[model samples]
Target: MDTDVIICGAGAAGLTLAVDLARRHIRFLLIDKAAGPFAGSRGKGIQPRSQEVFEDLGVIDAIVASGGEYPVQRHYTEDGTTVDEPVVVRSEPTAAEPYRIPLLVPQFLTERRLRERLTELGHIPRYGRELTGFAQDADGVTAEIAGPGGEQTVRARYLIGADGGSSTVRKALGIGFPGRTLGVRAVVADVLAEGVTADAWHRWGDGTAAQVSLCPLYGTEMFQLQGPLPFDVEVDLSAAGLTALVRERTGRDDLAIHAVSWASAFEMNARLADTYRQGRVFLAGDAAHCHPPTGGQGLNTGVQDAYNLGWKLAGVLGGAPDALLDSYEAERRPIAEDVLGLSTRLLEAARNRDHRRGREVGQLDLGYPDSPLSLASPGHDKGVRPGDRAPDAPVTGAGGLPTRLFTLFRGPHWTLLGHGVDRASAPAPRTGLRVHTIGARGDILDPGSHVRDGYGLASGRWVLVRPDGYVAAVLDTAGLPAAEAFLDSVGVRPPL
Candidate 1:
């Protein structure tokens, strides 16, 4: 095989997966048709979950330093009535360390960070290389690509399509993208508008026809505008037209539209692939799911997809069973479907002029509520909830090193967390599990309660957290032997 994996499309998903695979010492190639990284901020808000994934990738600090945080998000009526007070929800860190809130970095900056990380890992994305076609068999996949130089063939054990909504690989595999497209059209423009403060996401509309959102972008007093335009209207975003829209919408006729950084006309749609995998080929990101950007979930969902698939792909590449790969589709497809549903509903709510309802629905942290990956205990309901990304909380060790509990999950091990338990009674080390004893008093729980109360962690109990920060299994310390056996059955042996 030319490489273990051939990832088509060097967008957020593809680049993130490539970086992860590189970290795992897996051989992979990331190809894109674009000459280089696309410029300008497109998908701007990285959600809390996506921020956790960036921390895992060791890039969140740089992202935060480069981007600003938008803490206060408010919902308002079209007539400027405050529907809800600004809610300040702190984005805690995950099971990983260095807790920080989600940053408002443009998609371009995100791509740049991933690209730099990939380069540092000694695997630069192959630019101007487009996947033309591919064929997969029982052993592996062989893809044909048309590059700037010429056509080339790449053989790999696995092929992943991250090439956006119009994914050629998915089409070649005969996967159907089923979803609905909105009849109304929207024009998204990122521009520098003076006088608009960079504090919150300003949304205005009633339930039905037109809604507008003005969100801050990093530097340059820039903001991204998204709303409905006339179906018959052609989106010619000349400087004058953009300034007129700003003045008309915000009632600031003196506002100057400096640079129309990026402008595009898009029809919102909610779609998901019938299947995420076919034999040795797999699909992720926009290739597998497409949804309206109501909750700023487009890029966030794609990055999360990469996070979920990365370690699993790494495990399989490291000689684990192929069944592990099946879990990717099982776990992520539902999340995508849920996101699509929520985003569609949010768009509808915006159309109906129900800004409060829309914001409430959009702010919901929808997670895997039904997955067995959660701790199956009766009273424990905090920390990382099922179907939701784990939240980070600060913890101090006996040595006084102020470490984030998530730091214990740095490597590719299934972390076994023992809250309020004595270190002497910790679970025995196995092949793929890392055991840590976290305090119930200071570290494991959020403020306002004991760690045990925060995460519902009982003394001498084991909480199995997946590499991606999802709760994989929870067990009483007495069931440690059984848990070890289960881990073995899943091919995840705790480190010895």
Candidate 2:
């Protein structure tokens, strides 16, 4: 095999997965049909969850430094009536890691950042390489690629189709992409304009006839206009057409289209593959599922797919149980399906002509509930319950080490954090579990803090945190014996 994994597509999902695998010392070949990095900003928002993933990958700072800040978003009726108060959605309190709200960096920039990081790790995505076809068996998968030089054969332990919606790999694999094409088509344009506030995402709703959302891009007076066209009106989306729409909608005839970087018509669709894994070839990102861009979730969800699959792929390749790979589809498929359903609902709400309801659903932070991962310790009361993202908390010890629970969580390792347990006095020779002890004077509720408070973790209780920053097991002092047994069941050895 030329590599451990062959990732087809250099978009956000593919690049992120490659970088993550590289970090874990997994060999992979990442290919894309494009000549090089993208030039335009296609999808331009990074949700909180994605920011956390970026931090784990050690690239969040670079993204923040290169990207512009877009913190406020507002919705208004066509007559210029404010439908809702300007919502401050994207705010991160930490300077070292500031990307809580969805950042306004363009998709091209996001890919560039990921690529740069990948390069730093001594891996570069092979551009102008398209997957012609692929076949998988029990041992490995074989792929045919058409590159600038010509056709070539590449073999890998596994293959991932991160290709876009019209995926050739999916077609070659005979997988069905089930979904409905929307009746409405939206025109999107990225340009620079003066006299426009560069902070908020301004949306003007035309009661379902049409809608326009203007978002600012940093470093210049550039903005992105996304809106639906009239059902009955058929106009070519030339520079003149887009300018006319801006003038008629914003009442600003002077809104110059500095440069129509990229213009395309897109439709909202709700689609998902019936299966995420097919033998040794697995599908992810748009190849697995695609949804409307209404909630700004397309890129975020794809990046998350990489995060969920990267570690498992590395584990299996590194000699972990093959069953671990099954969890990739088990876990991420449902998330993508849910995101598809959510985006569909959001698109329908926007299409409903009810401005208030549309705005409400659009801004709602709909997350996955009822996950077994959210289980809490018995009789625990701190908000750091199970299945939820482990919150960062600040803690100060008697010795004033000035540590944080999240800082201790940096890794590819499962961490066991105890609030008051003395590390030196506790059991020695702990293997597979990185244990850290925090004394009093820690603030767990602060947004900047990595540790959450309500897990019934007292002076002697232990909190088991996963590599992805979710609580896997919580152990009261009395339940230590049972907790050790649980750890063994989960394929982890307890402290000796």
Tell me each candidate's TM-score.
Answer: 0.85, 0.84
Residue 283's lDDT within candidate 2 is 83
lDDT of 2 by residue, 291-368 (tens): 787667788888888887887787677555677677677777777877777777767766764322222222223332
Candidate 2 regions exceeding 4 Å error are: 71-84, 87-100, 194-205, 230-235, 248-251, 352-386, 397-399, 422-433, 440-454, 477-496
lDDT of each: 0.73, 0.70
lDDT of 1 at 132: 84
**Residue range 97-173, candidate 1, lDDT tens digits:** 23344457888888888888888889898899988888888889888889887999889999999999999889998
Candidate 1 shows a clash count of: 24
lDDT of 2 at 40: 69
